[model samples]
Target chain A: MSKNSMKESYKIKDNYNTSIKIKSLVITLICLILTIICLLPIYLLVINATRNTSDILNGATLIPGNETLNNYKNLMALDGFNALTGFKNSFIISGSAALLSVFISALTAYALVVYDFKLRGPAFTFILAVLMIPTQVSAIGFVQFMIKIGFFNTYVPLIVPAMAAPSTVFFIRQFMKSSFPLDIVEAARIDGSSEFRTFLTIGIPLLKPAMSVQLIFAFIANWNNFFTPSLIITRTEKYTLPMMINTLSSDRYTDYGMVYMGIALSIVPLIVVYFILSKYIIEGVALGGVKE
Target chain B: MASNAQRRIKHVSYAKYGYFFIIPFFLVYFIFSFYPLVNTMRYSVEKNLSKEATIYDGEFVGLDNYKHILTSPDKNAEDYYVHAGMREGFLRALSNTFKIWVMNFFPQMILSMILAVWFTDAKLKIPAKGFFKVVMYMPNIITAASVAVLALKMFSNDSFSIVNNTLLNWGLIDEPIQFLADMKLKRTIIAGIQIWMWFGNTMILLMSGIAGINPSLFEAANIDGANSRQVFFRVTVPLLRPILLFTLVTSLIGGMQMFDIPYLFNPGTNRSPGTQTIAAFIYQIYMESRIKNTGHSGAASVVLFIITAALGSIVFYINRDKDEIAAKKQLKKLRKQAAKKAHGGLGL
Candidate 1:
C-alpha cells in the first residue's frame, strides 16, 4: 500500500511540474511584452529624433530613414546646439553638483553614524521630513533666495542647492550604518590614526560603492533639473540639458526633430553613466529597497 | 600613564574632527535649504514687488490668503473652488490628485508584489535578471519633463500617433482615441505613465523583501506537502509586511506631491482641471504672483505647507503603529527565549 501511494504521489508531482513549466512560460512572455511596452517610448523617440519634421508629421515608420543626418545637422545649427558649449556647461554643472552633494552627504552620514551626539535623531528625522517637500514647494522662495544672494543666472544657484540633498544624506547614512563595519574603525583608531585622517584615508576609500550610488543619484537629479533653472537662469548660455530641451520645444518655431534630438542627447550621458556603474546602481537601489 | 595621555589626545581630536566633518553639511543646509525654508514661511506673510522690492505692508493676515484662494470665486463670478479645494484653486485639483494617486498606487503595488513573488520562485530560470532590472529602472532615470513630451507625441490626437494607429489597425477601436483631449482619459494616461515610471522601484523593493525571507520557512512548508500557492500566502506575504507598509506610506506621501508630469503635460494653459494637481495649482499661483494683479502666491505657499505637513504626519502615524506592533512581537520573542533558558527546557 505504501509503495502504491508513493508511486501515485510521484505521478502527481510530474503533472504539477509540467503545469508549472507551462505557467512559467506564459508569465515570461507577459513580462517580455511589458518590457517592450516600457521601451516603446524610447524606441519611438530615437526613431523620430532622426527624422525631419516633415517625415515625422507624415507618419514615419519604426525603421530609420535617410533624414537622420540631415535632422542632426539642423539640430546642431540651432542657437543653443553648439555641441561643444552645451556639453561643457552640462558637464561642469552636473559634475560639480554630484561632487559637492556626494561629499556633503557622505560627511553628514559619517557624523550621524560614527558620533554619538545630541540632536542626531531629530536631525535625521528632519532630513526624512524634508524629502517629502517636493522641489516645487520651495521653488518661489529658492529662486528669490538665489537672486538675493547674487547667485542668480549662474552655476552657483544650479549647483549649491543640490549640495545638501536630504535624501542623499538619509540614503548615505543608512548605507554607512549597514556597510561600514565598526571593527574596521576601531582597528584604525587602535593604530593611533586621527579621526579625520581615518575618514579621509580609510573611510572614504571603503565608501566607493555608496559614493557611486550617491554620485549617480546626484548627477541624475542635477542633470535633469528643469524648474529651478527655468526660474533662476533666464540666460540661454547657462541652460542645462533639460532647460535647453524645454526652450527648443516651446520656442515660437517648434522643431520636432531638434526637440527629439535634444531629448535623445540629454539622456545619452545618463545611459552611459548607468552602464559604467550598473553594478553599484543596482545594488544601491536593491539595498535602499530593503531598508525602506 | 602613557595610555591615558594617548586616549585624552584621541578624545580631543575626535571631537574636533567630528565637528569638522559635520561643518560642510550644516553650512550648506543653513545657506541653501533651511534658510530658504524659513524665508518661504516669512515671505508667505509679507508682500513683495518685483525681484528686489518686498515689504511687510499688509497686517499679519494669518490664513486670509489661504481662505481667499480656497474660497474665492473666479473672475467670471462662478465658484471655482470645489469642496475639496482648501488653500487654493478649485477643489478638483486636490480630488484629481487623490484620484490619480488611487489609480496608480493599487495597480502598481499589486503588480509589483506579484512580479516579486514570481521572480523569487525557485522553478524560474530567469536569464539575465540583472539586465532586466536595469532595463526596468531605465524610465526612473529619465527626466519627467522629457517623458511627458514623449507621451504627448505618442498619444497625440492626430492619426500619426502610434497608439491610435495601432489600435485602429487592430480594430480595437472604430476611430482614433482622443487620449489627452478628454479629461478622464488624460488623467488615466497620466496615472498610467506614473505607474510605469514607478513600478520598477517598487519591484526592486518587493524583491528585496522577498529575498530577506528565511528559506527554512519555505523548506518546512514544502516538507509538509504544501502547494506553491499555500506556501506563498502563508509565508511570503506575511514576512514582507514591514516593507510593504513602508512602500505604501512613502508612495502615499510622494503621490500627494505629484507635479512635474502634470505640469509638463499641460504647459502654458490650464485646459483640463482634471489633470491639475495641488503642485500644479501651486505652480500656477507662483506664476500668477509674478504679475502685479495677483499678489498672493505667498498665501498659496503657506497653504501647500500646511497640507503637506498634515498629510505627512498622518501617514507617519499610520506607519508608526505598524512598526510598534512589529517591535512588540520582537520583544515577545526575546522574552520567550530568556524564559526557555531560565527553565532549561522548552515549554509544553
Candidate 2:
C-alpha cells in the first residue's frame, strides 16, 4: 500500500511539471506576438520611408523600395520643414536644458545631502511637494510672461526653467541618500578646498552615475517637448523637430514617402541612442519607480 | 585639548554653503515656475481676453470665468449660442478627458500587473525577457508628434490607408470604416496609442516593486497549499499597495495633461470636438481661438491645478515614512518621560 501511494504522488508531480512547462510555453508565445505588435509600426515607418507615394497608396509593404534618395530630396525641398534647422534647434534646446537641469539638480541634491542646515528639511519637502505639479497648469501664464519679457520665440523659456526641475532634484537626492558618502566632503575640506571647488571636483565625480542618468532623461524630455515650444515659437525658422513634423500634416503634402522620411529623421537618432543605452535607461526608469 | 580641537572642527560650519548651493534653484523656481503659477491665478479672475484684433485686460471679474465655465448659459442673452458653445465645450472636454483616461488606465493596470508578475516569476522561465522589455518600451521614447502622425496615416479615412487596406484584403468587411470621422473610434484610437506607449513603462515599474518583495513569503505561500491565484491575491497585491497607489496617482496626473497625441491627431486647425482634452481646450481658447479667451483658459488651468494638487497630496500622504515618524514620536515620548522624572513626576 505504501509503495502504491508513493508511485501515485510521483505521477501527480510529473503531471504538474508538464502543465507548468506548457503554461510557460504559452506565455512565451503571447509575449513574442506582443513584441511584434509593439515594433510593427516603427518597422513599417522605416519601410515606408523608402517607398514612393504611389506604392504607399497601394498598400503597406514589409519590404523597402528604391525611393530613398527621392524621398530625401523631396523632404529637403519641403517648405517650412527644414530637417537641418529642426535638428539644430532641438539639439540646442535639449542640450542646454539637460546640462542646466542635471548640474543644478546635482548641486541642490548635494546641499541637501551634505549639510545639516535649518531649512534643509523644508527645502527637501518643498521639492517633493512640487514634483507632481504638471507644467500644463502654468503654461498659459508662462507664455504671457514670456511674451511680456520679450523672451517668446526664443530658447530662454525652454532652457532656463529646466534649472528648477523638481523631479530630477528629488531623484538625485534619493540616489545620494543611498550611495553618497559624506566623508569625501570632509576629506576635501581637510585639504583646504573651497566648498564650491569641493563640489565641482569631488562631489561631482561621486555623483556621476546619478547625474548621467538624469542628464539623459532631461535631454529626452526637452527634445520631445512640443507643447511649450509650440506656444512660444511662431517663426518657421525657430521650429523644433516636432513643430516641423506637425507642418507635414498640412493638406498640401501628398508625398507619403517624404512625410515618412521626415518622421524617420526625427526618431532615428533617438532610436540609435536608445539601442546603445537601453540598459541604463531601463535601469534608470526602474530605479526611479522603485525609489518613489 | 584634543576634545576642544574636535569641537572646533565640528563648529566649522558648512551650513552656509548649503544655502549657497541651493540659491540658483530657488531663484529660477521663483522667477519661472512660482511666478507663472501665481500669474495664472491672477489671469483667471481678471477680464483678460481678446476679441478680433483687440486684446482686453480691463478689470477684475470676480468668479465670472468660473461661473461661465461651470454653469449653463442664459437663453435670453444676445451671444447665448457662443456662451452655450463654450460651456458645452468645457464640459465635453472634461468628460472626454475622463473617459479616455479611464479607457486607457484600467486595461493598462491589469495588463501591466499581469506582465509584471510573469516577468518576475521564477518558474516562468520567459525567453528574451530583456529584449521584450526593450521593444515594449521603445514606443514611449518615440516622439509623440511622430506617433500621432503615424497613427493618423495608418488609420486615414481612405481605402488605401494601411489598416483599411489590410482589413479589406482579409475580407473582414465590405466597406472601409471612417475611423477619423467617427468620434468614438477616434477616441478609442487615442486611448489605444496611450496604452501602447505607457503599458511597458507601467509593467517595468511594477516588476521592480514585485522584485523588492521577499522570496520567502512566496515560499511560505506555496508550502501553505495556496494556489498561484490565491498566493497572488492574499500576498502579492497587499504588499504592492504603495507602489500601485503611486502608479495610479501619477498616471491620473499625467492623463489630466494629455495633449500632444490628441492634438496632433487632428488634421485640421482645431482639435476634433469628440476627442478634445482639457489641455487642448485650454490651448485652443488661449492661443488658437480667434477670440483668444484668456479668462476661460486661465480658469480652466486653475481647475486643473486644484484637481492635480488634491491628487498629488494623496501620494504625499501615502509616501510618508511611517517608521521614521513613529520613531520620532517614541523619542519625543522618552524625552518627555526623562524630563518628568527629573521634575519629580511634574511636581513643579
Tens-place lDDT per residue, model 2, B148-237, is 988888898888888998888889978999999999999999999999999889999898999999999999999999989998899999
Candidate 2 C-alpha error for residue B255, in Å: 0.5
Per-residue lDDT tens digits for candidate 1, residues B287-344, read 5444421235555665667767766665445333355368769999999899988888
TM-score of every candidate: 0.86, 0.96
lDDT of 2 at B9: 58
In candidate 1, stretches whose alpha carbon ends up further than 4 angstroms from where it belongs are: A1-7, A80-86, A119-122, A128-131, A183-192, A251-255, A289-292, B1-13, B47-59, B71-90, B168-175, B267-272, B288-295, B310-348
lDDT of each residue in A183-240, candidate 2, tens digit only: 9887777667888999999989988988898888898888888898999999999999
Clashing pairs in 2: none
Report the lDDT tens digits of candidate 1 across residue range A1-292. 6999999999999998889888888877778877897787888888888888877766647886567787678778887555446667878988999998888888888877786666665666666666556565566667677766678778887787788887787777767777898777767777778787788888788777788887887877777666677777777787666666555444344567766777777666667777777777777778762221
True contacts kept of each: 0.34, 0.67
